[model samples]
Structures are given as C-alpha cells and as structure tokens.
Target chain A: MKTENNRAWFLVLPVFALVAFSAIVPLMTVVNYSVQDIFGPDDRVFVGAEWYREILQDDRLQQGLLRQFVFSFAILLIEIPLGIAVALAMPRRGRLASLTLVVLALPLLIPWNVVGTIWQIFGRADIGLGGVLVTALGVDYNYAANPFDAWATVLVMDVWHWTSLVALLCFSGLKAIPDAYYQAAKIDGASAWAVFRFVQLPKLKNVLLIAVLLRFMDSFMIYSEPFVLTGGGPGNSTTFLSQTLARLAVGQFDLGPAAAFSLIYFLIILLFCWLFYTTMMQLGRGSQQ
Target chain B: MARIELAHLAHSYLGKPAEEGDYALRPTSHVWEDGVAYALLGPSGCGKTTLLNIMSGLLRPTSGRVLFDGRDVTDLPTEDRNIAQVFQFPVVYDTMSVFDNLAFPLRNRKTPEAEIRSRIEEVAEILDLASCLRQRAGTLASDARQKISMGRGLVRTDVSAILFDEPLTVIDPHLKNSLRRKLGEVHRESRLTLIYVTHDQTEALTFADRVVVMHEGEIVQADTPQALFERPAHTFVGHFVGSPGMNFLSCEVDGGCAVVDGRRIRLADDTAMDGAKQGDRWELGVRPMFLELVFERPTEGVPVRITHVEDLGSSKIVTATTGGGNLKVRVGGEEEIRDGSAWVVFPPEQSLLYRNSRLCGKSAAGQP
Candidate 1:
C-alpha cells in the first residue's frame, strides 16, 4: 500500500478562503438579513420563512419573473443564431477580417448606460434618425407611448449591444479548428452545408455552450439598458427580474423580501445553468467508449 | 482505376514565381501506372504533399495539366477529381457514427443507400471497423478515427486513385504496423492506383512496388524498390533509400582510377572515361552491404581505420575512416574483425559512380 499524505490539502486552503470571503460570507449575511425584520441594526425580530412567503406571493415580482424568462429566451433565440451567422459571414483572414472584428467590437466598447441613452433618443420618432426613418416608412414606431414598442426597443437594444460577444466567441472557436478538417471534407465531397453541419457545428459545441450560458445569465438579469431606454415604463412591460429586485431593496427599501427574492432568483439561474451544462455534456456520451 | 499523368506540373504558392527557389513543386512530368501502388518518399517540405495535393485536385498547379485516363482534369475541383486522400491527422465527423462516416463520401456522390451499406460493410471488415460501426466516430481512439477516415476513401469504388499524406503519422507505434498491414491488404484487394507519401523509407519501400524518391521539390528518381536499391539515378536517391543509406566519398577520376586522398584506387575495368566522367564533381557511392572489410591489404581496395562497431543482431555495422571520409560496412553475424586497420574493398560490380550528383554513364557498369 502507498503511504498517505495530507500535505496536498493545504495547497487548496487559499481557494477556500477566497470563496468564503467573496461568496459564502456575503451569501450568509443575506440569508441572515432575510430571516430577520431589521428596523435598525439594534431592533430586529426573527420572522422564520415569512419573507420568503411574502416575496413569492408578490404580484409585481411574479409578472417580472415571467417577463424575465420571456426576455431571456427571446434574446437567446435571436442572438445565438445571429452571432453564428455573423461569424460565418465574416472574412476568414486578411485586412477585411481585422476591419470587421473592430467594427463588431465597437458595440461592446460602449457602456451599457450609454447604449441605452443612445437608443432612447434614437427611438424618439421626432428628432432621432432611426425613429424618423421608421415613422416615415409608414410604421407606427414610438417606444415611449406603446408597451409593445418599449419591449421591442429594449430587445433590439440588447441585441445590438451584446450579440458581438457570442459572435466573437464563436469566431475564435471557428479559427481554432485545424485546416485538415476542411481539406478532408473537400476530399470527401462534402457540400458546404454538410461541412457546416458536421465539422463546424460539432466543433463549436463547447463555445456555443459558453455563449448560451453567458447570454442566458446576462439577459435574465438585464436592467440598465431597458431602464435607461424605457424606464420600465409603458405599464411595466419591460421590467425584468433585476429591476424588480432593485425596486424592492432600494426603491421601497424592502430588504427582507428583496433578499428572499434574490436568493430564489439566484437558485433558478444556477438550476438552469446546471441543466444546460449536463444536457450538452450528455449529448454524445452514449456512443462514446 | 485510371492512369494519372502529371504533365509538366509545377506549383508555387506565390502568384507569380520569379525563380526556381520560389516553387513548392518544381516542374515534373510523370505517369502513374493504372492499378499499381506507388509511394512518394521525401523529407519535410520537399513538395511531396504538394504533388499529391495537385493529383487529388486539392491544389491547382501554376503550370501543366493532370490527365486521368486521357481526360484533362487539371481545372477540376476536388469533388470532381473523383479521388480521395487521407490526411496526416485523423479527420472524422465528430457527431457521425462509424457507419455514417464511412458512407459520407458515398452519400455525397448520391450513391444508392443500399450500395453504400454493402460497400461500407466490405471496407469496415477490411479495416476491422465492423465492431464499432454503431459507435460515434469522434469518441474513438486516434487509430480507430484514422481508420474511419481511410474507410471513407475505400468506400468509393469509382475513385481514380487514393492518396495518403503521411496517413500513419498519428497512430501508436505498436499500432502503425497493424494499420499499415491493413492498408496494404486493402490496396491489393482494391487495386486502385495508390500514391502514399511519407518521409519514412521503410514505410515507402515495404508498401510500394514502385518507390518515387524526391528531393527539394523535385522528383529525384522513380523506379522499383530493387532498382532504387541497385541503381539510383540520382545521388539523393542513393542516400535516401537504404537502412543507413549509401555513403559517398569525394574523389577525382583519371583514366580507369579514382584518386582519393592522394591514393589511386582502381575502378571497374568497364569504367567509361567519356562525357559523364569529365564532370567537375565526382564521387563514389556504395551501400554498407556492398563494402567488404579484410585484415590484409588488398591490391584493388583502399585502406580504412575502424572507429566504431554497432551490432544489429543479424549483422554488424562497422564505421571506418577512409579517404578523408567515413564509410560504414555491414558485416555478417559470424564475422570477426581482428584489425583496427583493414582494407575496405568496394566491389567493382556493386560500386556506383556519381558525377554532378547523378549516376555516371547511366549505371555503375558504365553502359551508355
């Protein structure tokens, strides 16, 4: 038998300390705050699961949660495919590739609030070029006056600002594939579509997973762009979960319900992430040795 | 199967090459015999792959034409070339099953589904991929994946030729032989023209009846294995095709003698002192197997000082310093060398003469 050694355990101690300070401690404080009614630091009373029950029963938050899911799924459906298409259409190499990359990265360089403000004016239907052009094109386009318009404006704004992330991720992934694959495909008499479906799509699995998860989380917790562009306005049509949580904790100062709501929200996101990761990993496991 | 003629073929990655050095493949004209297996042997960046690629239509040569059975296919795309190539690294559709991977080319060519199935079964059995037919190709080990890649080429019954560019490079050392044997068996059964490219002399010599030796983007010599062994057209072939390869010693030719380091060694009585012998460069080439070592001084041979001995089980290779150079002599297992100073004999019949890096007078015997 080999001799046992516990020395390796100490090497991981720093990581544990880091997680405790960064996540575990903060999460525990939130948990502590959620279970107690804190009128002030000195005045407090344990309320059991009352905050959780109240938060779950909240009508506005329920609508916000539903809206959040719709928004997340909507953005994912549009961005992932659009990003892949953009990446596919982009030049493979040379000066044009550099120019396209810089142009695509321009959206990501703008701050979230600035993107929101830019669109807010751009969707005005009065002085803004975008709004004026659309109105002149005979479409009734006004983000401030209609709930559907506000929602559409927010979705469009998010796509414009963030689709580049997925595209760039996929671009780098596509570049990493060896030239031999394409040559082999050519020799095999594979059509253009067949090459994409078999060689490129399978190779892009891991990158697409990362892109999807990042897009899901970001879109689910979306707040700044929609807030600046629509102000959760036109009858709360664009108010997502993050906005609801913010209003609870800061706007109404209902920290107890907000903490409980956020804990539930965090668990939901974690659950979906786990679901996506496991399903993707298990897709080809059946045929593997 | 069809004969492939590469007529005045040349390629340079540059749009317009200004010099010979710019070419990846120097202008070459060669005709591959139908149903004959050939190996293209060369060092790295020697344009063997470029030539193979040109044949398979993966690359378009800057000049010349490729004729398959007298049909000009120089401008054809790879799909239209009706050829297949197995790459150095394994290339398999990650999501495809072994059966599907094998049937991919057939499917692309619109072969009947039933025909594809039967063809795959035959190739799968040949490659021993029958057991893994239902398994995902990407999940298999590298050897299995490579087999799948090769099976794709084998499934095509109508291919004019099949090209392999260092196909066994990624296989496990123990598995390379098994795969090579499987490939050889397939080639014999299919009898399609095979152009196997490799830097390994053993792989080329053992696999191909005809071995084409290349150097620096040019075909140095194309002949049978025995011809390459006995009479290499160029010195590069002499140095590239043997186990230890042929050894060369610089010398000057005068009448029927080769003067080496101020010592006169008699050449074969039939040595031709005509045009080929009058070149500025002269060297004598001989394989280790042809050189003999004797303790007593021989009147016909030169003297050498023994420096190193390597025992290779069945034979011993003795490195000797002679004529301002070193030569290796292969000795049989039972032979014993008793002297550090011995007379190294170059057998007249087996010895080769090279002038300007080519076989002098068409052969060692000085026949025109």
Candidate 2:
C-alpha cells in the first residue's frame, strides 16, 4: 500500500493562484471583449461571435496570416540547418571552444529593436555599406521603396539576429554526447554522414525539440523588428499577423475585431505547437519499441 | 586467422617526448599468435588500454610498426584495420533495431545483403538476442546492449581479431559469469584471435589461456595462467594475481641456507645460493596457499606465534607472526589450526627467491 501525500498540494497553491490572478483574469477579459461590440467601458452590446466571423473573412487579415506563415516557414528552413552546421564546425573543447561560444552568443544578446535599427541604417542605398556594395555590383537594391527588397531585408535581418540562439542550443546538445559513441562509430566503420545520421542526430532529439519550439513561437509572433525596420513595407507585402492586429487595435482604434483577431492568432500558434510536440513525442515513442 | 606483430611499439601523449618516463607505453616488440586468446592484465594506468588501442588502430604508436599477417598496417585507420573492438562502455545506435545494430558494421564493409542477413541472425542467436532482434537497441537492459556491442563484432567474418576492453565491467556479478562463459564459447566456436584487457586477476586468468601482466607501461610477464599462479616472474604479479597475495620475507645469507624469520629455508640450486651469499640482499617468496602451517613445535619448520585463525567457509586463513610482522597461511577448513605457537614450512618446490623485485632463483616451476 502507498501512503498519501496530498499535503504537498498546499505548497503549490500560491503558484496556481498567482497564475490564475495574472494570466487567467487578463485572458478572460480578452475573451469577453472578443465576443461583444464595445462602445465604451460600460456601454457594450452582446454581438455573439460577430467580430470573430468578421475578422476571419477580412481579406487584409487573411493576407497577413498567409504572409506570417510563409515568413515563419522561411525562418525555420534557413536557420535550423545553418545553425547545426555552424555548431558542428565550431571547436568542441579548450580555449577556442569557449571563445567561439562567447562569439556565437553575441548576436542573441542584442535587443530586437536595436537589431532592427542597425539593419535599417545599414540597408540605405546611399550611405549604408551593404546597400552601396550591392548597388555597385549592379542590382536594384532599394529596400524602402520596393516590397520584394523590404521582405528580403527583414528575412536577412532576422536570420542574422536569431540564428545564433539555435546554434548555441545545438552546441550544448553536441557537448552532451559521450566520446564512446564516436569511438564505437569509428570501430563500426561508419562513414562521416552515417555517423551524423545515426549517432549525433539521434542524441540531439531533445535539444532539437526545444529549439524548434522556441524558434517557432518567437518567429510566429514576431513584430518589433519588422515594425522598426520595414513598418509593413511599401505595399503591405511584409504586414504579418501581429502588425495587422496592432493596426486594428492601436492604430485604427478597432478594439472588438482586434481582440477576436488576437485570440485567433494565439490559437494558431497553440495548434502548431501542439502538432510539433505530439509528432516529436510520437517519434520518440516509436524508437523505444 | 592472422598473426599480430607489434615491432618496437611505444607511445607518448606529449609532443617530442625526451625521456623514458614520458612514454605511456614503453618500447617493446611482441607477437600475438593467430586464434589464441590472451588477456593483458594490470592495474589502472599501466598502459593496458594504450597497447590495446594501438593494436586496434585507434591510436598510432609514437614509434613502431604494427604488422597483421606480416603485412604492415601501422598507417591504416581503424576503418581499414579489419579488426573488431568492444569498448568499456557499450554503445548502440538508439533508433536502430538490434538486427540493424548488428548489421551496421557488415553494411559499412559492403558485405552481400544475403550474407549480412545470415550473419546477423547467427550472431544474434549466439548472443541470445534473437527474441529482441526487431526491438530498438536502446530499449534493452545494459547487459543486452553490451551483447549487441559484441555482436556487431561477431557478425563480421573477415576481422583479423576481436578486442574486448573490460567488457564485463558494467555487468552484474551473477551475470558476469555467464557472459564470460559465453565469450569463451564464442572464441572456441569461431576460433578467432581474441585479446582481452582487464584489471581483475580472476577474470584474466579464467578467460584467457595466456595472461600478459603489465607493470608501469611495460609487459613484465606473458605466460600461461597456470604458470602465472604457480610462479610469478615479478613481485607485482605475485602480489596481484592471488587473493591476499604472496608473502615475502627478507633473507640473511648463511652456509647453504637462506635464513628468514630466524629459520633456515633451503636453497633450490647453486644459482640461488650464489645470489644469497654475494648479492646485496635476497628475499624468499611463497604463496599463502603454499605455506604449510604445522600444529606443533616441529624441528624442520620456521617458528611462529599463531595470532589468529580466520574461518572462511571452505578454507581457513591463519595469521602468524615471528619477526615483528604478520604472515598469512591458507589451509583447508578441515585442517586443525589452533591459537598460540605454530610452525611454517617452505617447500623448496614452491618457495621462489626474488632480488630487485624480479625472480632470480631457479624454481621447479620455471618457464619451460
């Protein structure tokens, strides 16, 4: 027979109550606003999902959602593999390894708005070093007036700023693998690619899952860098879901539909995160059998 | 299938090693006959792993040539050495099934698919891993995983040799015996050259026919396990090979006798007699199991006061003292041993003489 330990629940009551007070209250208020037509603080009418229906049908918000998905997908495609390659190439021990780790962490330490501002000035066609070099190389390189160029600049800026976070996470993952695995792989006569596929990759699953979650959430909800850099671009080509939500809520002063749009945006991130987590967990379970 | 000859092999971790003390493995030339089982036995940090790694092609010797079947292979990497090695810690590709884990080396070597199937199944069966062939390798208990580590080696028929570096270090005591016996069976059935490295004397003596004892980065003695037990060439071997170890007593030279603990121990031959009379000093070596303890005051034995008798289930270890120190004597449990005065007899056949920590006297059990 097992003894009961229900007394431990009292110790966890504070954290649970704190989460309810801080998160649940604000979230319920957002839910309340999402369903009603708000004229003032006390003057409200029960619209019953009208804002949800209207927000979902709006072409501008739909375009923003599509652009948001593509941007996040491109970020995952470019950063994950490049980060792993950089981590693998870095030294694994001694003074050089420490120096490399410190260097890799530098880009991640820069605040988002500062990174956006630096890239903004750096992309000017006249005085910016990068823009002048590209212009000298004989290409149309104006980011402020061209939608395609603004999109490219924002993508490049995000890659430059955030790829190191993935690399640092992966470097720690690689360090966790013991030397015996490499020795056994050598004794097994495995090729270089085979070692990565069978040994290193399998050992890095947990870290990769964490990296994917963090990067996915960060990129899907991204706003500050693009807001500071492109400001939704020349034609709305770079207007992502968060920028569209900000336009409705703060810029245009449309509160009800904006609340409904923000809730839908939160749900999209939640759904994708659940899918990624379940898929990874299922892969882990499949390997155990 | 192939003889291994290590020609003047030496290794040093330092760049430009200037002295003999810098070497991890001192310079030595040795040969391992084909299809013979040998164990390199030593305490930790005694160059056992260094020598094994050199032979396995994992580490290059600082100065030497390694020849397999008279073909020079000192420059080859571990992949081309065609030798199998099981590590101290077991390694298995987690996502792979036990069958695939066994087939990995075979597939890398480009063996025929038909051959791979039969070979993996056969090796897996031999390792008693047939039931879990389809299960993931990482899902098994450690002993099973260790068996998979060895099975990967067994699946390859073209390997010149198989090396095990303390393969049973992580195994439970009850299972260690079965694994060792299985290894012995595998060696007999396959007739493959096996070089096992270990620090445990019992494991070395029981697993291999020939035990190579190393001390301080050099091979001090390489001989039959029986010979190692009967007559150890170095004092370290004498102290390390047996439980409670062999006893040593300093001797004073006298006419035709070496007096130790105020008693005369007969000299074996004139070679030992010359050393007893002229050498700086001589010491008599005898195993506790070989030292007979008599109950009475015998005229022909060394006098000792019986301090204690330890009754181990099957045998009794009698501790006696004569010259300000203890002397251990092992006798059968049925043997009558009481407290107080006793006599210890050293047979000329079993008593060996050592000078400078090395065997100097000619004993009956000297190497043939």
Candidate 3:
C-alpha cells in the first residue's frame, strides 16, 4: 500500500495567526490587568493576587456565582428530557416531518438580544398580552416590582427560545435510527415504556449530552435576555455572574476587578464543559466495548 | 406451539374498497400446522410480508379472523401473540452486550438470573457468538450483528412461532448458506414453529418443508417442495417455484392432439382434452430439467430452434424457440449442441396444461 502525504498546514497558518492575535493578546491583557492596581491611566502598580483576593472576599460576586449555578442547573433540568419527548412525538418521514423540524428551529434562529427584547414587551403586566391575560385572570402579575416574577419570566423565556434546539438535535438522532430496531423491540414483547427506556433513551445519549452541555453553558453565561428583560433589577434578584461582570467592567469601568471576575467565569465554564465532555465520551466508549 | 389459521383474510390500505384492484392482499384461507417449517415465496410487492405481519399481529387484517389454536387473535397486540421476529436488517442495541441482547426477552419476562445466563449461553453457542458474549453488539461486523438479532429471536423457546422476514437478504452469499444450515439444525433441535419469508426461490425451496407460493396478493399453492415442483396447483406456482422457472408455451387443443404455432404435438392420452373445447387459449408448462434433449431425429417430438446455451458444471441449460415461443431445456453434461441449429423434445407425460391461468388437472398420462 502506498501512503499519500501532503503539506496542508500552510493553508491554516493565517487562521492560526489571526486567532492568536485576537484571542491570546486580549487574554494576556486581561491577565495582566487582573493582577495589577492602576491608580490612573499613567500610573500602575503591580499587585499580584490582590484583585483575586478582593474577588473572593466580595459577597456580591459570591451571590452572583451562586445564582449562575442555580440558573444553569434549572435550565438543564427542564430542557433535555422535554426536548427528547417532543422529538419522539415528531413524525419520522415525509413532508410533515420536515415541516415540524422547520417549525421547531424557528425560535432558535432568532437573535438572542432580539429574543430578550421581545419577551421584555411580552411580559409587561400593564400593557403586554401576558400581563393583560394574567391580570384579567384575577392574579397579581407584576414582573417589574416582584423579583420572583422577574426570574420566572426570564426562565420561561429562555425555555421557549432554546428548548427547540435540543428537540431538533434529538429529532435528527431519532430519525437516524432504522425501523428495524422498533420492529425487533415489538417482537421482543417490549412494553411501550421499555422500548423508550432500553432502545430509544440509550440511543439518544450522545445527542442529549450535547444538548445538556450547550444549554448549560449558554444559561450560565446568559446576559442579553435577562439584561433586556429585567435589567437585573428588583434588588439584584435576577443579577447573574455575567451581568454582574458587565456591570463592573462596562458599567463602572472597574477593569481590574472585572478582568479578575472574567477569569473566574472562564475557568468555571471550562471546568463544567470539560466535566460534561469527559463524562459523555467515557459513556460512549464504554458502550462500544 | 399452536396451529395458525387465517380465515378469509383480506386487506386494503384504502379506506373504502373502491374497486377490485384496491385490495393489497386478496381474501384467502390457509392453515399452518404447529411445529412445521413453512416459507412464503414470492416476488417484490406480492404481499408476502404483509401477510406475515398480519399473522404476527403487527398488522390487523382489514377483514377476517386470525386464529391460533382455535382462538381468534386478530385484535391482539404483538406482545400478546407470543411471536419472535427477525427482520431483513440487523436490529440490536448498540449499548448492550451480546449476552444482554440475547437475554433481553427473558429479562423482560423476569426470568430467573441463572436461567437467563444458561439460555443466553445456549443461544450464543448455537449462533457461534459465545466468544463475543461480553462485547457490545454494535461493534461487531454486520454479519455478527445479524446473528445477534437471530439469537435474540431464537433464545426464547416459549414463543409460539419464530418469523423470519428475509433475514438472510443482507448477509453475504457464503455466510447465508452456513446460517441457513445452522437454522435448519436449530429448527430440528427445538421443533419451534418457523415461518420463513423470502423472494429468492432457492432459499425458499431449500429451507422450507412446505412452501407456500404467493402471487398478486393471493396464495396460488402450498405443498411440500417435491409436490410443488411435481404437481403445481396453479400456473403461477409452476412458474415461481423453479430455477429458470417452468417454460410456458402457448398451445391449442384440437381432437386428440395439442397444436402449437403450426406443429401438432402428440399427447400421451386423449383424455387431456376431456373438458376443453376447440380453439381454447391454452398453455403447456414443462420444467427445463424434465425436458429431454435428443441428439437424433425422434418421433412424437416438437421441433425447436436453439437460441442460447448456458453451461453449469454438471448440466447445461439450453434455451430454444419453438412454435414462436421460447422454452428452456436442461440437458446433462457430455451432450453438446450448436446454437441456432439444435432441436429438442418435451416429454408428454411431464407437461402441464393451463386454462385461464389456473391449473386444469395434470396431464392424463400423469407428471413423472
């Protein structure tokens, strides 16, 4: 057998240079800022680990981090299983199947900021449709003044906008399965629940893992939607870590503290994502053996 | 095991039976004896699979009852019918070990742990998969996965019947022969009712004890392999049951002789025309293997023009045109003939006569 060889690295050199210039340079700048104390633009002092210490001691950052964890966990709990169920209900072949897919994918195509803005108006207690309906139903429906109402509105909006992504992924996974599997399940005398548990669920593991990780990362770093909808208002009840970081860096121009917070945020996401990826990959390998 | 019966079963995918052609499967009645191996043989779109599905309770017949052991099960679900089915393609859980795949049905029924292990071992050994018991089923080759699927069906000994729907179609030709032989051995050892469905006549004839020939949504004949070949109950059966099939030639019956395009072929007995009138559209059917090729001029033989000759190692299939229609004759080795100049004869006793597509009785001299 002849082994073919070619030089393809030359073509990718420019992309590598561009990524390093944009990503590495900025990341180093953040690291530099994170450990320094700047009295002004011209005078700066090297204060190693001082900002890190401040960040750790700050109670507000801790609250933001806790809220971020809870929000991401809650989103995952609601989306993954619901997506699988919807995908199972979808038709397998023909025009109806494609049409259902297109419909499910519509919400995902909407820009994240636009999604937040739309829900902001839609959830208004005094003028919007959601507010009018809730008020007419003889209930107190004030999202502007109530922290619980604001959080609930943000969570529901995120579910509505993103659950379809998980569903679409799961739908494709389910479609890839041949009809022979179901036929065998039938002949094996499997109950409906058993079929889903043994055949369908195990098959969907890869897709579900992807859905979980994507939704978790997105929810953890959520800023645009809640920012537009509630402005992290009602006394920081809806203020997540991303929103808090933005408030410090862009809102108050505390670049040093914000850069420190950003590193923590990045590490947290990287940690969780790594955990999710390794766990799923191990599961996939285990099944193959 | 239970004797399966289909009573006047007919099916149509259309909501209303608008015309005679609307039915996908025409009404017919047949009985399958318990513990007997049967094959439903037909071409594509012949409703053989549909009938098998109906029998397995996967598809309810549009009309009529399906009885098992004299009890109507037409409305029963597949799980309640106690049937194990192997499909055209392999279907096994990728995450499960081969042992688990074989033990799945037993586990579903809550079979004891020790029994599950023993049964799984038994089935795996039978399928030559004992060494791969702990490996995941999905990582194996397609043929191995198919064996796992077969084992899953065979592992359960309590099922009333095992249904195989073209299970060997996806297997390699060499592996198919071995798997088929293994299936025969397993069938003999277990004596479970087996219903094999296939479009390939070779597989059907070699694997089945009683072959059911189906055509155009109806069964034309059901009998042992020898009976189907020697005494076909319908013209379709004769054409569908043999390799190269039966050669059909158009003919007309006069007083005591059947006339082809222009030549009069002698009949062994005049009673072949007992119920036939003159000028009736008739066809004479003969198997290629039964038609003897003559080297010298012989009396009472039809003249033919040899068109093509295909030689197998032990025999030669000679294709010839006679009376404006084509016929195939299988001659033994060492008999040589030149294409376009060879002549042949059809043994009168082995010929079958047909009228309006149904078998008019056998030739009066009888089929040998």
Candidate 4:
C-alpha cells in the first residue's frame, strides 16, 4: 500500500491562484473576444478564423510591421557599438567612476512619457535647443512638416534615451574581468586591438545578449513614447505596430480584429526573441569548439 | 639567459612613505645568476608576490635599478623586459584553443608560421598536452589549464627569465608533486633563469637549486636546501624551514654553558662567550630531529613529562614539557614512548646558541 501526503500541495495553492487570476483569466477573455463579434451586450455572433484572416490581409498592418522591424533593427545597430565604446572610455575607478555612473543612470530613471514629452518640445524648430542648433547649420530641418525629418527625429530621440542602459550593462561586464588578464596580455605582447577583440569582447558576451534581447522586445512593443512624441508621426511615417493595434481597438472599436492583431504581435516578439537567443548561443558554442 | 641584478631595491605602495613600516620591501641588493632555479619562500604578507611582480616588470619599485645582463631596464614595460610570468591562478583565453594559446607569444614577436607551429608542438609534448592541443582551453580541467599556463611560459624561447607565482596552488594534492617534478625537469632542460615564489617548504626545497628564505618583507637567508636545514641564518629561518621547526628555549649564560630552569645545557664549543657581559640574554636552538627521547634517564638528559605522541608512519613526533618549556623530539615510528616521565637529550654538536635571534657561532653539525 502507498501512503501519500497531499498537504504539501497546499503550499503552492496561493501562487497558482494568483497567476490564474492575473494572467490566465485575461488571456482567456482575449481568446473569447477574438472568435466572436459583439454588436451589443446581449447580441453576439461566433466567427471562426475570420478576423485572423482579415488582419493578415490588411495592408496597413503589414506596413506597420515593416516599420516596426526597421526601427528595432536601426536601434540595435546604432546603440550596441556606441554603448561599448562609451563604456570603454569611461574611467574604471575612484570618484570619477562613481560620478559617471550616476550621470549615466539619470536618463533611465525618467518616466517614459516624460521622456517623450521632453524630446517633443526639445525638437521644436523655433524654441528647442536641438532644433535651433541643427537649423543654425543651414540645413532645412522641420519635423512637423517633413516625413523624413520626423522619422530621423524619432530614431535619434530613441537612441539618446536608451543607449545609456546598454552602456551601463557593458560597464558592469567590463568591471568583472580580472586585472590578471590584462597583465598577461601585456606580457604576451598583444596590441590594444587584440586585447579588445580576444579578451574584452569574449568576456562581455552574456551581458550583450541581455542588452540585445531587452532592447528588441521593448522597441517592438513601444507605445507611450512615440504616442506622446510624434503621435504616430506627421504623415504615418513612424506609425509602428502598437499604435496600429491601439487605433484598431480603441479608436474604431474593432474588437475582434484588434484581439487577433494582439495575439500576432505577441507571437512575433516571442519568435524573434527565440531566434536572437539561439543564434547568439550557437555562435558562442561554435567558437568554443 | 641573463644575469639579473637588483640594486638598492625598495618599494612602498603609498605615495609618500614616512616610516620604515610603510615599505613593503625594505632596501636590499641581490644578484641571481643565469641558468639556475631559485625559490623565494616566505609566509603570507612577507612581500614574496610583491618581489615576484617587481622582477616580472608588472610593478615598478619606488627606488631601484633592475639590470639584465648589465643593462638597466628598470623603466621598461613588461613586454619589453623579455620575461614570462605564470600567475598564482591560471590565466587562459577562453575563446582560444590550446594550440592557439601556446602560439600567441611567438606570433606577437612576428615569428614565422612554421616556427610557431614547431615551437608549440615541442612545448606541448614536453608538458604532456599533445593530445589536447585542439581542445578549448576554457573547457579543460583545472590541472590541465594550469599546465597550459606553464606551457605558455615555456613556448617563448627569447625570454631571459621565467617567473612563477605559486603556480601549482590550485592543483590537486596528488598532481602537485608530479607537476613540481616536471618543473624541475623543464628547468634542467631549458637552462633558463627561473624564479619561483611559494610558501610551501617541500615544494621550494624540492624544486629549486637554491632557496631564498624571507621573513618580515626581508630576505633572511639564501642557501642550498641542506644548508638551510642545518644552518639557518636567523631564528625566523630556523623556525620557518623545517617541519615542527627548530625548538627554542630561553637560557641564562653561565660561562661556556647555558642554564635552563636551573639545569645546565652545554653549548657548542665554538660558541663565543668572551664578548658576553653579565646578564646577557641567550637562547638554545635545536632541531626536533636532533633531540631524542630516552627511556632510561641519562646524566645529561633532562627529565620531561610526555604530553602527546603523533605517529607519522616513518617517524613519531614526541611532544613533552620540561622545566616549563616545550620540547618536541622526532624518533622512529616504531619507537615506543611512555606517557609518564622521560628524559630528553639534545646533542651537544647539534645545539647552538643565539643572541638576539642571530646565530652566535658557526654550525658544528653542517658545513657552512
């Protein structure tokens, strides 16, 4: 005969209830709304796979996705190398290091919407410092009237706001390396470029992976900053995926299609994150072998 | 190989050292000849690692001149000094293979590709790392990584000296002895000036041709292993070199004899007593190996109460108390020692007198 003690499961009941109430219930409601069309409180009709088909066929959603991909890719390319360079140039010890760390962390602590509002006013051609300085160089710069200007402004704003996070992560990674490695490298007669390539870069792999994945996900699902800054742009030039989903759900009240779009957006982020993680890990392993 | 000389070397980490205690290495002068293995042995915080780093050019002494083959290279960087140092913990490039790791130094000097490959092969064979030449250095066991660290030092042929800072500290106990023996063989084959720093006496005595014993940030003695064992220059050396070390007892000098607790123990015949005034302080120093425990009390033996006996397979260390002083005697393992009163005998030839921690006369048992 087997004696079983079931009281141990009681310890896990609260966590299970919390997750079900917070996550599962809302997810199931979204699934329900995705498959049915509701015209009124009491009148509804069941529609299987119609909204998914329609959202996939829509040209506006496709364009929004392309814009989102370009923005994320551009952000990653500009921030990672710049962040590493900044981290390398920063001082490694004493009062100057502490002061630099506090200054680097300042931008990350500001509210997301506040960051957008600051950049929105900061980019005005008439009164803002950024605009007056750029216009003084005698190049036509008007973000509110030109689409290209608006896109460039938004990309630059995002880089300025988020690059410090990447730099801070890289700084911590660089600090963890032992001084013995540099000493050994000096004795081995390695050049500065060799030390950076073989020693510094290899040691920073794990932190760089984290920085890439986080920046990718956050930029893909970005809503508040762009909403407050350009309001999806001067002429839909910077209209990304989250703005499109918000317009479909709340602006037009297209509940079924909006629900379908949300699911697709979540899945896309998940797929890309998996791809980034696996490819980088495979590269690391390949080097090891 | 080159003859390395340090002239008036002293180091202080502080910007302005006010007193003698602020200096890590006090002012000293020494010369290390070419093609000899020397070990710097000292306790923790005795400036052993500091001296090693200074010699390797990883650190610049506050005031000193380091000469290599009669040329001053004190201001040279580590790479320009033509010296290789293996750190206390193994340092290996995680991204590189063992073959690449060994070829790094040679490639930096712009050696031909063929020569680099041949040198790596030779070093790998000598270090028994030939089978794992293609393996990633990061994935190997600790001992293997340490061997690769040693191999990197040996791969470079242009280096005038190779320094090791407690290189085998991270290896397993069973492998430490074998690695130590391999280092001795490598030193003999390469004939390069090798300086190793370690606190383990067995490793120092076994691996180096001459050992420099350090105490309180200063080198007290530099001699062969047998000489260090038989004739220590200072009390610190006599206490530091041997297992259970040399036993010291406070004694009152009475002409040519020393009185310990109202019992007279004769000092060596050569011990100088003519210069000694009345009420002079002296100590009798004797090694445990020379002290014997006799079952029957002899006229010259002092009675002792055996407190403990430690069986060490080949020998037994008999610890006893006599006249308010502790005496440890090493005897054969099979030698039976009773727990009650026993007599301890200190050989007259093996015993010497120390005045203010300095040897009073030449050692009679071992040739100086």
**Clashes found in each candidate (C-alpha, N, C closer than 3 A):** 0, 0, 0, 0
lDDT by residue for model 4 (B260-280), tens = 778787766655455676666
Ranking of predictions according to DockQ: 1, 2, 3, 4
Residue B210 local lDDT, model 4: 92
Listing every candidate in turn, what is its Cα RMSD in Å to the true structure after a full C-alpha superposition? Answer: 2.2, 2.3, 3.6, 2.8
DockQ of every candidate structure: 0.66, 0.65, 0.56, 0.54
Per-residue alpha-carbon lDDT of model 3 for B1-368, expressed as tens digits? 88999999998888899876888899989998999889889899989888988988888889988999999999998888988888888998887888888988888888899999988888888889999999988688999999999999998888888999999977899989988988988888889889999998889889988898888998888888997887676778888888778888888877766678776766555565677766566877779998877756777577778878898868888888876599889888668777665456767777766666655643322221
Residue pairs that clash (backbone atoms under 3 angstroms), model 3? none
B82 Cα displacement, candidate 2 (Å): 1.2
Candidate 2, TM-score of its B chain: 0.92
* Ranked candidates (lDDT, high to low): 1, 4, 2, 3
For candidate 4, give the DockQ: 0.54
The Cα error of candidate 4 at residue A114, in Å, is 1.1
Report the C-alpha lDDT of model 3 over A168-253, residue by residue, as the tens digit.
99998888777777878888878889888778887888888889889989999999999888889888999999999988999889
Candidate 4 structure, TM-score to reference: 0.93
Assign candidate 2 its CAPRI class.
medium
| Chain B TM for prediction 1 | 0.94
lDDT of 2 by residue, A1-289 (tens): 7858679889999999999999988888889989998889899999998999999999998999899999999998999898888888999999999999898888888898999889898998999988898899999998899998999999999999988988888899999999888888888999999999999888888888888888899999999899999898888988888998998999998888988998999899999999889998778657543
- Candidate 2 or 3, higher TM-score? 2
**lDDT score for residue B351 of model 2:** 82
| Kept native contacts, fraction for each prediction | 0.85, 0.71, 0.60, 0.56
| Winner of 1 and 3 under DockQ | 1
TM-scores of chain A across candidates: 0.96, 0.96, 0.92, 0.95
